[model samples]
Target: MGEAIIFKLHLVLGTTIFLLFPFTRLVHIFSGVAAPVKYILRRGYQIVRKRT
Candidate 1:
């Protein structure tokens, strides 16, 4: 195996993932995973910002 072959494999996998992002359960999975992190961070920010 060579570096060129590894790069091609990575490029192909990345392309496939990009293509699948909007048309499959991949969308749900990504957003489902990110939403709570945003919610949790925002909740903590509000609690800390208003301490007076």
Candidate 2:
């Protein structure tokens, strides 16, 4: 009985993780582009501002 319960818990947890994994990738798909643009703009700003 204990083994069966453990097996069922493992199955449920595994399925939950597997199902959620791909949607998590949506974060990178949507937000990934803005980061590099911000980095480049900030670097350019520092270059101009440093002269003063």
Report the number of the highest-TM-score candidate: 1
Choose the strongest candidate by lDDT: 1
Count clashing residue pairs in model 2.
0
Looking at candidate 2, the ten consecutive residues that score lowest on lDDT are 39-48
**Tens-place lDDT digits, model 1, residues 1-52:** 4578889999999999898778863354456667756655653334456667
Give the per-residue lDDT of model 2 (tens digit) for 1-52: 2568889999999999989978873444455668656644553334445555
- Each prediction's number of clashing residue pairs: 0, 0
Query: Model 1: residues >4 Å from true position, as ranges?
Result: 1-3, 28-52
